[model samples]
Target: MLRRVLVELRRPQTPAGLAARLGVEREVLEAMLASLERRGYAGLAYPESPTCGVSCRACSLKNLCPAAASEAPQSPPVWRLTALGEQFVESAAEGG
Candidate 1:
């Protein structure tokens, strides 16, 4: 399931999109995403700026950005494959 998730993440996608594509619940997908992030397999396409925090509500990118694992907003975050993740995907494609 984790590998399938990684394969789907080759392109940027919101959590909702991912969930729908994988046929899983949003909450379950979020948990998997969090696990991948912790293991350095995947991460945010655009991480929140250092200055941004709880005040995301006031930030102009509030609707454009996805919060880290700590905050599981219903709004999807754009997730991407990390370097190692990409390599893994490529290797898998080559039947490695």
Candidate 2:
């Protein structure tokens, strides 16, 4: 069965969001995310974003963005599904 952690990552979100959604502690979520990253199911939207960038709220790649494209701010990392993750989730959904 697909893990709930992996399923929750179908959408990109901050670490805090993931924790809140799963109702788990941050440490547990971090471990899960690390494992997924090692297995290649998920990763940061972008390795990094422009320093003090603007909000990418409307763009599809916004999650990866470290900051909005405008000016004066930054955001936390956004975890997202990789190609393999998408395939995994899709196949899982289809199977069950």
Candidate 3:
């Protein structure tokens, strides 16, 4: 789950945003995000839009997600990949 979240976060996403995309519960998603944050794999980014309550609301990648529309509006804050996250994904993809 964390690996999947890392890949999605490479673009941008919130705990709720990812949950929506993955068809998972917000609580489950937030736990994954928190784990990523603790491991220095992700970080939060505030939304630029005044109407966007959650930072992930404005993410361009949301449209491509299967579960994007299912998530509730009040999902937790957005999370983005940290440098470590990027590296981890790349290495994992390379069979590291």
Per-model CA lDDT versus the true structure? 0.72, 0.66, 0.66
Best-performing candidate as measured by lDDT: 1
Ordered by TM-score, highest first, the candidates read 2, 1, 3
All candidates' TM-scores?
A: 0.68, 0.69, 0.66
User: Per-residue CA lDDT of candidate 1, range 7-30, in tens?
Assistant: 998775788889999999999999
Query: Comparing 2 and 3 by TM-score, which wins?
Result: 2
Model 3, residue 77: what's the lDDT? 54
Model 3 segments beyond 4 Å from truth?
47-76
Error of 1 at 83 (Å): 0.8
Model 1 misplaced regions, further than 4 Å: 47-75
| Clashing residue pairs found in predicted model 2 | 53-68, 54-68, 54-69, 54-70, 55-68
Clashing pairs in 3: 20-67
lDDT (tens digit, per residue) of candidate 3 on 12-96: 6656667889889998888878787788887665444222224345655556433245443334455677667878999999999
